[model samples]
Target: MSSIARRAAAAAATGLTGAVALAVTLTGVPSALGATTGTASLGALRASTEVAVAAHGVNKEGYEGDEAPAGVDVHQEVSTAQLVEAADSVQDPAATGTSGTRTGIGCSGDGTSGNRVQAVYVGVAGQNDRYDAVVGALRAYTAGVDGVYLASAMEHGGRRQIRWVHDSSCQVVVDHVVLNPSDVASFGAERSALVAKGYDRGDRKYLLYTDAAVLCGVANVFTDTSPLQSNANNGGYAQYARVDAPCWAPQDHSVEAHELTHTLGAVLSFAPHATANGHCTDESDVMCYVDGSGVVMTQSCPTTHEKLLDCGGDDYFNTNPAPGSALATNWNAANSSFLFDPPAPTATLSYDGSAAVLAPSVPSGQGWRVDWTAPGCTPATATTTSPGGARLAVSCPSGGTVTATLTQQDGRTAQASTAASASGTPAPASSAAPTPTPGATANPGPSVAPTAPATTPVATLALGLTTVTPKTVAGTRVVLTGTATTGTAPAAGTRVALQRKQGTGWTTLGWARTSAQGTVSLTVAPVATTAYRLAAGTTTSAALTVTVTPKVQVSASGLTVKGAVRPAAKGTRVALVQHGRAVATTRTDAAGRFVLTAPRSGSGYAVTVAAQPIAQLALSAR
Candidate 1:
């Protein structure tokens, strides 16, 4: 065989498990294939190889004129045993079932909230058919990334799933972005076209699945390379990732995942085993770089782990890193908000006449509890006994106010309330006293009537319950809003106090009066996890918990990294992190201040404060 063909064979056997095979034939020139016996079948492969070579200088010979150095082809295919072991490491699906094929693309996670990764079908303007042939495969591919074993009878690990954009039917949502192929001939052009179509947003990571075969795939790797600023700002690059049609097939799942990981900020250039181009040098890992043209690759993890990320769990994507590990201190792709576990249990209250129904949105038979109070009645509690997102009913006889407080399994609490007038009718007006005629009061004989003593009218008040806008913060401010009502009417001008639970007692933090619309708002910056509620006179709303993550303010001059933690307390641990590695550690003095000197790596730095325990009162009771 020719030297080029020999290299091609080795690349197919060792480089990205299935990518090189799509780019080259085992016994052909690296750049192009001559007319062969199976000319018809090889036509598409030939065209793809030419595009990859012309666009990326990627082929069996090497990358950009660089030949593969000796001993570089060390990676091998993963074995069945290793695959089984990796599968065994995953958490079992809490429920037993397989999801049906998702037909259409929709928003991520119920389409309403959270950071999302939207899939876009970018095609040549004239192409018809929304690439429907590959949609199922793409979804299955995503499931595999979340640790599902494709060969198994039932899927598992609803524990972690790609937060893909999906429609109301639960089918994957893939938006169409058709452009003239000429306009997006390069990766930069592709991104520009997407931006021109208004795909740029901080909350989204756009995954572009293109029908064009310009190159295998490419993505922008946004990193924070500043010495002083927090690397958390790198979230601005959540906008783009692309997979070319030629780079993937129904049987190949890793390429799209490979490209998507780049958008999630993986394999930083400073990673312990990463190449100069931000790919790991370790083999048997999805994010590893084994193209044979750059840094020498090592077969550190067995080939079975080729489909997994961070084979050793130290480089980029560890779900739970050991204390003081690189992933524990720096950026970890697993921590990306684009991936999510099953949602937390939730309950919402709605009214059905005099009955207030507490409806829980949770998995079937998940345990839940609720405590409620009705007007002119003592508090009552109930728990779910059957299955599904069950509903509990509370009766309110007087129709003044009813509040239901729900408790999640993890002890978090949420409250809902409703107000309605009894009988849907207005109260009768009090009768006025009879006036005496001008001079007719002198008849004080036997038939005179006596007057009854006057009585004052009483009013009932209700406080509308709402949680903080952001239930969690990193030393930032959160806005709390509430509404007050007096017997089914807006309680305008009602004085309300914002109180935080403090050691079994409530402390007033701020006070405000209800607006003309009965709305009240308070902005607070809490340094620790705390329970808060709104109170008007003797009536208090249900508690809301706001969790605070310690924020580390970092500034570096020369080799010194100095920072302070908010809610400053003595002995707060601080670490200087860079390139997915923590290089220095120190403890704050009495003022929550700390300083450490680190070697200049020019790739930027991040300050991470060790998690400090904070006292919190449980907002939920059994």
Candidate 2:
């Protein structure tokens, strides 16, 4: 059967006939399910098929080949280290010190970079805050394909991040382009909107991440009748790709990377294992279509290879291809300019009035060091070190030009100086946003030059008692508000950081620039009872503890009651209390799930985890 007919039969068998939209595979073929391609009017495309969320248990979306691919002996099984690395890739840790603003409002890349994958989150207008999940998925996908982390556009502080169209107030701007319920499968509509928004640069490979429940993922493949050199097929043919929210996981054949692989010119028609379109017939390969091609897919590599590119290394991406080999002669993805191993380790030193904090960007297996000199400070000169340490803080009140030299274990050295200044009175809150403080400077990376002169005195900044509100359950965000002052005057434009107590030192969670009135309001999501403080330079607010209790999810089935607690820890006690008494008690299992026999006569029951109040649920006696 043809790919379209097969898709229709499957959709009908699964009762997903009307709900199925156009399936655009790597070949850019618009499935018979009703999608028009290449200069066809979009109105006809939208009218041809209904866009409904697929409720089938099986995910029928993604590449078109056939059957389960067979696993092979040569493919490496996933190691614990690889799993950990994959997990780390998706983690979005809070930023330290003052948060820097970016030029773009809602997206993550500047069109200037050479052949970079622009991370984009097509969130609903006026209703998103840096879709952290999308960012995490992109990071994970990039990390898995290449050892190096994906590079992003630099913000004000030299931090690489996603960019989208936003106004001066930092609100996302979507130009009447709807991709959610309406244009979910209208790839052309999305492409047009992005192009109108100045995202049509030929050098960029735009990774459009959307919450839309469209097809699993889709991208246009650039290919020819024969194998060509990697340089000849490098770019510009296909630039934008979509990875719907459903397929963002790194495990689903590394969906984002797989779609991107298509745009990167993989599995040429001339390749030995190439399928009709741009997919290979090899099993355990990310670019191999698992379903519709005439050739049945069989894994020639281990199952772990599903998260990788070419299976045998002879197809499209062998780093060191043998001479006269297909990969050596044709377009190779491993040689793409967009991919690279992680760069050398480097650190930055910045003195924010009250203290000098050294931040390092160290690659794997590398250590960092910081040596400083500030004559008037306590212990004028000292050295601090840590094994791949995240940050090091030093107390230096006499600012002036505080200089610090950082050396990586390999002996690569970089020096930076911050001209710290004394605290000044904050201007009254104005209708306008305060000028953003110049980002900290370092010799090794991009930095905004410090504004203060070298001879400026040390700042004596202090924070007032902070106030927190609305004690919340786990997974909810909380707000902390306070003000910074220089003596009795407001210290406007000073950078204030929110820090959490960890061990003996305070770890910076997130930071923001003080308002014109010197007030700062920071938001954080604490999973457990956490001690937090506000800091400006070395001065800090009184420690305030925010209490967070584990949230419980309870459901009743027949005579049995089952529930789970977030942050599931094995051995945590849970009790279903009735009339201020424990009626049923159980300990959470490793999955944080628990079960208890419902009392035969219970009408109202309160569930508690570790003696903390949870939601009240009514268990009906059947």
Candidate 3:
């Protein structure tokens, strides 16, 4: 089917409110807290990475007389070591400090990064598997085909402190709060009622990760609809979504990523501004609207073009991009905007006679191997999956020095040496270079070639000119239209500003939030030939100069005037003066140009351009 036809049919099927009612996945059964917050400094760096809040205009309730507000019920957040910095994983936790402004969000729980947080996860009837669905989808979106964690960067709006870890190593500590019918009553049906009833049970909430948590339910989420639909310009302190087709039930992580990013900020009614809605125009994004048909819509299928339930299964561009927008790409396509740099592995090494052990801190998905160089000593060459931590056994002289080489997932390597004594004399100083701070990239291969991808530049948002009403202007005002995508069509209600270059800086003339296909048309009139551009979020389109032609005609006669100009004009008087004495005066025609013929030339003459004086127009009839 044509992309347009498919989109139209999908819209007909679910009638999702493009912005608020985008279908998501998940299904949870009330489960217990499996792992406690452990002080496992196991590669846990103590650096304080800054987290910014994007939810600007949440619907805070004032129901002291009744139930709590929309996002009042606070959940416990899992405090796994928050990712601040990592030079290929092993990092100095104290090197960085927390940054970014924190707005008061209902779920900004405990004020401390929980050592662990939970939400009311609801999904398909009879199935108690919301947690797994979320986790799997989370894995699918955050950890892509290579298994590197890429979603957390969304929290800081593409600033920094992003890193990757093994699927086993980067495992998040999460718990769940089972959602029931009474719980979702607020979400599934009418909108504000969800808030009213939700305030009543404000007591139910679940786990918090480093990022803002979302309340997963199975109902439609928009309450006010129309004028409210115009709210892409605002943000919510917390997000409450209802997954339809409850088929993926609560398992659809793509939708989860979509709603979750709204709290962080993206594809708003206006780009770069966290106003109103939180969805992109791109259907591939987790935030785009979709026809709730099948269950699995996120994973990349082997078939080319074929997708599961309209989901943009290409996990590459999972999140939408805008000005300050963020996304995950292969390390090869990474630029300064991506959170994680091209990875270089870091690890610790030790050895015993006949055995050498090496542990590496990889940013997930990297395969690692350890090697040994000592008389009679050989270490295991097979790679230990990142989570497993590479370990090798070798036969070495007891009194001789044994060196262990650790290979990283990206082909970079680090090595250390330890001298062993039969009597155990302090094990001869061990030497494995300290890991660099996160964001500090390096390559140290252990006798092997690098496996890291080639360094290719990438962008946060892809914006370009698609259409304009008057291809060539015959007048001043022209209608210009265009498209912007993080990689897909933006959600409805998001803003796209029409900007004009004024002298040195660009100023906003007006905005056109976008239609379903991620396009916006705005009629703008520039007084003269002026330059124009489009701004959405932090992304701006290339400057599109709209050529404006002004009609300014000058003629000379006795007390007469004639002229023409476009768009029409703001009034200005045209004085016909001979020397310093006025002979005749008339207002410029409504079109901006004017004519004034003096009855007599008594002295010097001076006629000039609107703003700049024209010396050539001075008549020499002294």
Once superposed on the true structure, which residue ranges of model 3 sit more than 4 Å away at CA?
1-111, 114-175, 178-180, 185-236, 241-253, 269-346, 359-376, 379-382, 397-415, 420-622
The C-alpha TM-scores of every prediction are: 0.39, 0.50, 0.33
TM-score of predicted structure 1? 0.39
Is candidate 1 or 2 superior in TM-score?
2
Off by over 4 Å in 2: 1-259, 267-457, 463-467, 496-511, 525-527, 533-543, 551-573, 579-581, 586-596, 602-605, 615-622
Per-residue lDDT over 169-268 for candidate 2, one digit per residue giving the tens place of the 0 to 100 score: 2223322333344434345556665655666554556667655544455555444323332232244322566655444444334555666666666666
The digit string of per-residue lDDT tens for model 1 on 1-622 reads 1112111111111011222211221222322112221223234334543222121234544322122223222122121122222322222221223211111121234654556777787767753323433343344334444332111111111233466665543445667768886655655566656666777665667777776544555654433222111232133333466656434421212555666676666566446886544467667666665444555777777665555567677777666667876667667666666765533434545544423444444321123355555655222433332121123333434555656554433233556665633443322211111221110101001111112211323456778657545456444567788889887789996767677776676654434678999998877655567678987644678888887776556665667766666545667677766655777778986446788777654554566777342221111111
Ranking by TM-score: 2, 1, 3
- Ranked by TM-score, the better of candidates 1 and 3 is 1
Candidate No. with top TM-score: 2
lDDT (C-alpha, whole model) for all candidates: 0.48, 0.48, 0.33
lDDT of 1 at 238: 37
